[model samples]
Target chain A: MFNLFLKTMYDKRIFIIAWSIGLAFFAYLMLLFFPAFKDSGLDQLLATLPPELKALKGMIGDISALSTPSGYLAGQFFDIRMPMFISVFSVILAVGLSVKDEEEGYIRTLLALPLSRIKLLFGKLIAIVVICVATTIATVSGLYLGALSVNVNLDWTVVSNLSLVMLLLSICMTTLVYCIGLSTGKRGITMGLGILVGAGSFLLTTFAKSVDWLQPYEKVSLFHYFPAVDIVKNGISIWDVVVLVGITILSILLTIILFRRRDVR
Target chain B: MTIQPVLEVDAVTKYYGSFLAIQDIHFMISKGEVVGLVGLNGAGKTTIINLIMGFLRTSAGKIRLFGEPVLPENAHKMHPKVGFATGDMSLFTNLTGRQYFAFLKRAYKLKDDKKLGELCKQFNPDMDKKIKTLSRGNKQKIALISAFMSGPELVILDEPSSGLDPFMQQKFLELINHEGAKGTTIFMSSHYLKEVADVCSRVLFIRDGKLVKDVSRAELESSHGKAVHITTSRAIRPPAQSSLLGHQKTANGYEMSFIFKDSPIKLQQWLCSISYMLDFTIEDHDLESAFSDLYSKDKSEAKNV
Candidate 1:
């Protein structure tokens, strides 16, 4: 089963590597080249966007003290880039491992095996988590390496801190999408819904702030606890850690329950 | 000969909404026997297999596998004990034949890679190309390998010879016979009676969701081939048919080949009186005739009924 997960994860390595490279380039161009834009809130760029788009990319984390290489790298990677990477990773892993198997007729072969449904789902979830962690660590390290060429002070504390925070948020989103993927028997539906859930949460959170009446809806949005911007500015909060763990438990439990109850197509 | 029944289906009836697919289907297969479920398309052969596999719910009746009821939760686990290859089952397109074979081998918990390789080499299915690239016959060979890879006690194949060339079909027959010789019970369903006759020890005839015949190989061999044709050496004496049976004249003479349900000897004596000397003999019955006879009966009886 571990081998099965590894085999599937190996197939998606290209996607992860490509994404990490793209994230590194974005981080380098925005942080190193255009330094002033870090604080410059282009109101047109931020405000003209629809409410959903704004809500999706919650308040940007303050990277003010991010003068050093590691701080700037961590601020960019973990603040905005890591969440996107994690969400994409989570959604793809969840959908690929769950729905794609059925859509491609591999599930027939997989189910023909002498394993239980829960076991297959459990192994896939573990594989998704492992991929998420490996990709996150690589993307963060790559961002830092990109900063290395620019000659800035290194700070492992900030990088590790940011990684940990992003890891928590990423796992939560992955588990949630993983469950949704299991519920959706087809690949297209799973992929579509997974993207919506991940990106939609972010937009919902941003919209919640602007519309006072919709603020309560923000509490349920995963971006509410993601704290990408907040974590960089204020460090990790105790409540965020607690809420993240709670999210993991809730999502995993839902995944297991859905797997057990849902019919395997 | 005393032998254990390898598979038993008892009073099983399944319904898809108001559409009744199968009704009270009951049958059993002895150990090492090659059993064929003979049915036309839409006669509910697949439905029966689905119920046996616990893929669909049975509204009534029960199916016992090796004397144990197949519980819903444990049905998937039964794969190791039973190898099933369906004609319409979708093959994984991305995996190469080798990869797919290896996957099934591991899934079935066959530790000996050498054995798996040897078994595959016997059929010589292509390993380099993905399933999507393979021809229909080659793809079927791959499917057969996966189905037989587990070396289970029972193998249920639906339309097993479908899409195979004559050579492959013969190979398929040999493969199934090999499994049977090794004490594997094969319960295959096919619309082609000749194919089933090649390997099946018993033929179970199904029509309109009912089992009409459970004839053994010996019985089928003896009866399925007997065809009766009566010809006369002399002209008929009276009204087309006195009352014995419908009569028709041929180039030879007046002839009547009413359904011959009696021994050739008895019918010979009876026909001798009708003509000075009659040229009459029983022609072997082929599947086409048996099928036509049965179907014609069904149609006629249905109209009368």
Candidate 2:
């Protein structure tokens, strides 16, 4: 299991490094523009907007808090941007590890080794978690350094809490994709369903605020548990963490069970 | 003391959805035996190999390796004692051959690289080049080396000589012979009849998801009988004999050929009964002719059914 883990990590080293650098740079760029938005009288502009346009604010956060450091960062980055980017990354990673490998017959080489299917999958899961944690740290570091450069007094604890939630959310997305990939062993299905779930969850949660019919079902969407604006203002919520962690664990168990029952290529 | 077979496939059946890939396939290989599985494409050779390797589970029945049942959960425990290589086996494309070997070495928990070095020297693969950059034959060399490097007790190969040149194929056969001499029971699937005849002590013929025949080399040679060619003086009706197989007439009904499985005395009596017989010759039957005869008979049987 350790050997498989080490090999997976080594194989994905370049991928992890590239995502970390890219996400960090993106976060830095977003922070660089935060000061401009704060000084541009955007609050008054947002307040004067029509109600129909105002309803779209659910996708980001409270329009009134757009001028504050925590709210601006949450609304612009953590709320939608970070989750979208991480989800995309998670889908690709999961598909590559499962469906792509099987389709290309590379999984046969690994299976021929003296390791059980469960160990092989667990090794890959650990590697995915490590990559997600590394990228999250890079994003947080970029945010902290960007804030320092702009002389913004930011609370590091709340930011870390938000980062933790982001990490869990990304892991949840990855495990879901991994489960689908291993279950179907089809690249198209895995990617399509992975993107749908990630994007669908975010859309459902966002529209739930304005669309009364979607409110009760909002909890079904993974993004509903990830209230980025609330996390930035009020620190982490244990219930949200529990929900994400529960989904991740369930996805992992389902992945193992399905993968074990199927025929490998 | 009775010795246990190295591999035992007991009435194993596999189905892909509703399609029966292999049904009630049964075979066994003892130690120091080199067995070959011969079949046409989609003949369930690979399916049986996958089942034996525990990459696919048996729908009905069981497969055991080294006296333990081969289940996906416990298959890995037997993997250290088994080496598997397939023609289409994919390697880590980004890694050099050397790196791939290093990973395998770690996975197998080998004490030293001695066996790997020996295999590299024998196969002469370019260890410094990435696998993706290598040719098909070169990649196959890497696979063969990896399978043999661990010095497994039982090696299973599926079309192991697919991309190999004749020279490399000869080298591979020599390796199989050498390993077999060391009491390593080897089971391989191949389309190359000559290769099977050269190295395998026993050959199993699979056709349409069933084990059609299993014969040892000595039994195959003795039981297949002789190829007979006879020239007649006139266009007379050919003698009706149940032992005659694949009978064909040419040269305006003067020349006739068939496989004679009956005794030599019976052949002589039948030949003597034909007064217009001009000339005749009988020779030992070859495996190629035997294989074709078996498949052709099967095709006719299927058509009849």
Candidate 3:
């Protein structure tokens, strides 16, 4: 399993490095712009703006959320952009890990070894999960570094909990991509569904916040359960954690079952 | 006690949706048997091979390797005993040949690098070069080396010599012979008749997704005839009592070719009865002629039907 994991990650070094560094840089850059806004009294100026415009800026809940370093990081990054970034990264890795091998005829050679198919897939799955964790950590650490550089010490408790939420969201989205890719063995389908679901969830979340009638539809979006603002403003919800974790486990189980049943093309 | 065969494909059938690729195929290879699968393009040879390798799910029937039923989920258990190479397989283009071998070694959990090093030297592949840069023949050599380096009990090769030069082809034959001598069962497919006849103990001929012929090497050597090619001074029709296989016009008036599956003296007597031949040459019937004869006969039979 470890060998398979190493081999799967072998060709993905560039992708992992680029996404991790990009996420970290985005965090650093976003945090770098925060103090200037705080010093210029733009937070109060922003508070006076119309609610719809605020929702457009991805600030739907508390106006105070953007005033602090933790709230600013979660509200600006984790709520919208971070989930999008992580979902894209996760989908690429997961889909590539599950389907690309069979497409490239690598699975035949691997299956010819003494390892079982389930074990081989699990190896690739574990590698993808590890990559997701690394990118998440990089983004969170960048947030921490940017916060400390400005002498605005972040609450580790809230930061860790928020990171966990992001990671769970990533797991749920990636496993969905994996299941689709494994079942269909078509990169196009996996990618199309991945983007539609990954980015679409965010779209639904924002639309739900902006429109009163669409608010009920937010429950269907995976992003709804993460509640980045809720984590930042109040505390992490155990029920939300349960929902995200449950979705991930269910997706994985379904992926494995469907993969075993489908023919390897 | 009767020893179990190395491979037993019993009543195996495969269908791709509504199109039947191979149907009711049955064959067995005992230990140390070198069997050659031969056919024209799209003759279901590759389909059968993929079925045995568990790359495709059998629409019906079963394949047993070393007495163990082979299925997609349990296919890996047979991997340690089976080494397979195919022209259709795609290698990782990004990795150097050496890196790819190292990766396989790790997957197989084998510690010996000496076999890989020896194969690299024997095949003379640029080990450090990326696979995408190598020529097709060199990539083929890489695949062959990977298949044989492990000294597996059963080696499956599909058109293994397709991209090889004459020298490498000879080496590959020698390798197959060496493996057979070591009691390793080898199943291969090829277009080269003489090579298959030289190394394989038995040959399986498939046509239109059916096993049409299965003959042993001894049977082929004794019963296969010689081809007689005769050129006439004029475009004269065959004699009213002639049993020639085929007659076609050449630069010369006409040339007639046919297999004489009888004593050379009888063939000479039959030739003596023909008075108009200007030139004639009798060549020993090889696997190629015998195979072509099978197809020609099949076509005539199909037309008659």
Cα lDDT tens digits for candidate 1, B1-305:
65657778989887776888888888988778899988889888888876776555578888887777764445666667888787756676667888777667666778877756766777788888987898888888887777778778888888878888988888889988888888899999999888887898988887778877788887665544335456676655322212132357768777754444456566556666663546666665556566555546433332100
Candidate 3 structure quality by residue, lDDT tens digits, A1-265: 9987887677778888988888888887878877875566656876888876766554443344567877777777678777777667767777777678678887767776777878877887787788789888988878877877777878888889898888888877887788788777888988888888877787888777667788878888888888887897788898898988888788778877766655676
Task: Name the candidate that leads on lDDT.
Answer: 2
- In candidate 3 the C-alpha lDDT for residue A101 amounts to 67
Any residue pairs clashing in model 3, and if so which?
none
RMSD to the hidden true structure, all candidates: 6.1, 3.5, 4.2
| Clash tally, candidates in order | 11, 0, 0
* TM-score per model (chain B): 0.82, 0.86, 0.84
Identify the superior model by DockQ, candidate 2 or candidate 3: 2
Clashing pairs in 2: none
Instruction: Write down the lDDT of every candidate, Cα atoms only.
Output: 0.69, 0.84, 0.80
Model 3 lDDT per residue over B1-305, tens place: 99999999999989988999998999999999999998888889988888888777899888999999888777788988888898755777778988888877876777797877777778888788999999989999989988977778999999999888999999889989988998999999976777888999999988888888788989667546677788987665443322366677877768886666677787788778777788989888766767777766443432100
For model 2, residues B1-305, the per-residue Cα lDDT tens digits are 98999999999999999999998999999988999999989999999998888888799999989899998667888999989899978989889999999899989999998889888889999999888999999999999998899999999999999999999999999999999999888999998777898899999999899998888888666546667777876755545442344334566457766666677788788888998787888887667767776777443442100
**What are the runs in model 2 whose C-alpha is more than 4 Å off?**
A45-53, B223-226, B229-243, B246-257, B260-273, B276-285, B297-305
Q: How displaced is residue A53 in candidate 1, in Å?
A: 16
Interface RMSD of predicted model 3 = 1.6
> Which whole-number lDDT from 0 to 100 does residue B98 have in model 2?
92
Q: Candidate 2's fnat?
A: 0.75
i-RMSD of model 1 (Å, 1 decimal): 2.9
